[model samples]
Target chain A: QKEVEQDPGPLSVPEGAIVSLNCTYSNSAFQYFMWYRQYSRKGPELLMYTYSSGNKEDGRFTAQVDKSSKYISLFIRDSQPSDSATYLCAMSAGDSGGGADGLTFGKGTHLIIQP
Target chain B: DAGITQSPRYKITETGRQVTLMCHQTWSHSYMFWYRQDLGHGLRLIYYSAAADITDKGEVPDGYVVSRSKTENFPLTLESATRSQTSVYFCASSGAGQGLISPLHFGNGTRLTVT
Candidate 1:
């Protein structure tokens, strides 16, 4: 099984609606969860970050991590057309020193917010 | 100033050809990474470097290589390109901190098409 799993969603929603995107992982060792936004022909940009099992809120976005179930989620309030983009969920295990091992990512979910 | 810049924003090459994608960052970050995004496959790490001259393989490393000769640059080379290697390549950098906890800054991706 892939380390991380996310639905490839082209979810369409109306503007001002609430949007939720989620991911699940098979590795319990993953401790850091992150959400990234990518527009067409652009690079993925960091959107939300969380450590372990907890919830973090930034602006209109909220990231929640549940370590027990290895599930992570990102919620966007008052979604806008500008929020139409692919949402990627990424995670990493705790780093041991400066090694280049840790970051693992899931297949992103495409989202669209229409007027 | 450009945080991170990728050269040859778009590239097309034939099979068995050698192509190198260049990534440079102005932040002097201690960590740099190479990831490829394929349709319906999200983003997968190909390689990463914690510091100059230190590198490691990631999830998918076959047919590709990376070198970090300087803190500000990380380049990915396709030794012999294959059709499967056609994907959007992204380079990211992070400050001196633990992975799984640090937020990465990404550059505009390089769209590579191997015919």
Candidate 2:
């Protein structure tokens, strides 16, 4: 089984709808969790970040991590067309020596906010 | 100001050929990484460097190689390309290693196709 698993979602929602994207991991050592957004033909951009298990909120986005369950989630409020992109969950473990090892990424969920 | 840039945004090569993708960052980050994005696979790390001359293999680093001769440049090379290696390649850099909450900055991906 893959270390990190995420549904390859092409989920479509109306504007202003609340969207939830989630990921599950098999590794228990993952300590840092992050969410990235990738637009077509562009690189993945960091959207949210969390440490260990807990919730972190920024602007209209919220990231929740449940270490015991090995699950992570990203909540988007008031979705917009600009939010239409691929949402990726990434994690890292161990001491990064001021920078951790490479991040383990999920398959990413493709989301579209319809007008 | 260009933060991070990738050369030859699109590349097409034949199998068994040697190809190198260039990644440059201006942030002077301590960590740099190489990842490939394929269908059903969000992004898999191929290699990463903690600093110049300190490189390590990532999840999928069999047919590929990386060198960090400088702090700002992390190049990924496909020694002998195969049809299965056709994917979108991305390079990312972070200011600090794992434990610290550092967000990664990414370059516009390089789309490589091996036939």
Candidate 3:
């Protein structure tokens, strides 16, 4: 199985709808979880970041991580057409000395917010 | 101008030709990474560097070479480009303060096509 699994979804939603994107990871050592948003033909940009388990909120976006279940999620509240993009989930198992392997990324979920 | 930037936003080259993608960051981050994004593969790491002169291979590094002669520049070179190597390349950098778990800032991306 892949280290990280995410549905490559072209999920479409109406404006102001709530959107939930999820990912499952097989690696238990991943302590740092992040969500990135990528527009067409552009690189991924960091959206939300969380350490270990728990939830982190930033404006209309909220990120949650569950270490026990090896699951992570990003929720978008009141979505807009401008929010349409690809969302990628990334994580890493960091060492104490700082330097460690690069993050493993899941297949991004493509989202479309309809106006 | 303050963030990471990648050169030759679009490239078209013949197979077997050598191609180099340039990455420059203004932050002088301690960690630099090279990743390629494909339709089915999403994003896969090719190479990474923790500091100048230190480089390591990542998951998909077979056809790629990398050098980090300076902290702000990490270039990815494909000695003999293959059709399979045609994909969008992204350069990212993260600071050392948060170690390997630091959130990455990505460049706009370089789309390369190997004919």
Give the candidate number with the greatest TM-score.
Answer: 3
TM-score of chain A of 2: 0.95
lDDT of 1 by residue, A2-113 (tens): 8899999889999999999999999887777889898988888888877789999999999999999889999999999999999999887766322245367789999999
DockQ, per model, reads 0.49, 0.60, 0.52
Which pairs of residues clash in candidate 2, taking residues 3 or more apart in a chain or in different chains? A96-A99, A96-A100, A98-B97, A99-B97, A99-B98, A100-B97, A100-B98
lDDT of 3: 0.90
Off by over 4 Å in 3: A96-100, B97-101
TM-score of each: 0.94, 0.94, 0.95
Alpha-carbon shift of residue B6 in model 3 (angstroms)? 0.8
State each model's CA lDDT, in order: 0.87, 0.89, 0.90
lDDT, model 1, position A93: 74
- What is residue A64's positional error in candidate 2, in angstroms? 1.2
Full ranking by TM-score: 3, 2, 1
lDDT per residue (tens digit) for residues A42-114 in model 3:
8888898888999999999999999999999999999999999999998888752223456789989999999
lDDT by residue for model 1 (B1-115), tens: 9599999999999999999999999987888989898877778889989899999888899999899889999999999999999999999888746433357778899999999
Q: How do the residues B14-96 of candidate 2 rate in per-residue lDDT, one tens digit apiece?
A: 99999999999998888898889999877988898889999998889999988988999999999999999999999988887
CA shift at B95, candidate 1, in angstroms?
1.0
lDDT of 2 by residue, A27-115 (tens): 89898888999999999988887789999999999999999999999999999999999999988885552144778889999999999
The per-residue C-alpha lDDT of model 3 at residue A27 equals 84
